[model samples]
Target: MKDAKNVTITDSEWMVMRAIWTIGHATSRELIDAMNELEGWSASTTKTLLHRLIQKQAVAQHGGSRPFTYKPVVGEKESMAAAADDLFDHMCAMRAGSTIAGVIQSRELSRADIANLQAILAEKAKTAPEEVQCNCLPGDQTC
Candidate 1:
């Protein structure tokens, strides 16, 4: 499996990954059927996406039969975290707290969700460094 930071799953690829993740593992024909049923995509389209995913090391291919079964190389949580980090990294790090607060306030979180978020935040706060280093890109002004 490639490092999480190196994996880039496009929106279309995510759909295929989601199906494979939900099923735990699936063959090409099974994946094509599932994707077709869900999004009306052709077999070739699904195959192309699967091939790209495999090339990117986002999906693991298992052998031992005529048709191989595929599974997500990266778990959902890891993928989500990497995607989220990418989004935040493009924004101003200095305003990250405000940005996160705004997003939280925008969402209608359930009680359990709120509790879980609170616990996660508390744990993260405890381990957070006193000073964060800025490694923004040269052309970027939102450091």
Candidate 2:
């Protein structure tokens, strides 16, 4: 299994990964149908994407016979976290809190999710700095 942090998934590939992650394990036909229905992708397009994922070692093929089963070699949660981290890494560090706030406001989070976030925030607040430094520039300039 490939480590999610080490793998870089494209947006289109993330869609395929979502399907595979949801299904747990699936056949090529199953993936093709799902992609067609969800994204209106052609069978060849799905196949090509699958091939690329396999080469990346983010997915693995199983069974000896035809219609082999495919499963994710990378974990869904880990992949999502890695992707989020990658996005934040590119942005100014000072904007991360506001960006996170925007994301939290935009999404429909469950009560449990909210509570978990609250707990995390409470813990973090104890040691939280008064200000976040901007990393977008070489010196003290802010973005």
Candidate topping lDDT:
2
Tell me the RMSD of model 2 versus the true structure.
Answer: 1.1
TM-score quality measure for candidate 2: 0.95
Tens digits of per-residue lDDT for model 1, 1-143: 55677899999999999998899999999999999999999999999999999999999889988699998898887888899899998876666887889989999999999999999999999989876555565654445
- Name model 1 segments beyond 4 Å from true: 105-108, 121-143
What lDDT does each candidate get?
0.88, 0.94
Best by TM-score: 2
Q: Can you list the residue pairs that collide in candidate 2? A: none
For model 1, give the 10-residue run with minimal summed lDDT: 133-142
Off by over 4 Å in 2: none
- So what's the TM-score on candidate 1? 0.75
Candidate 2 C-alpha lDDT tens digits along 1-143: 57899989998999899999999999999999999999999999999999999998999999999889999999999999999999999998999999999999999999999999999999999999999988987987976
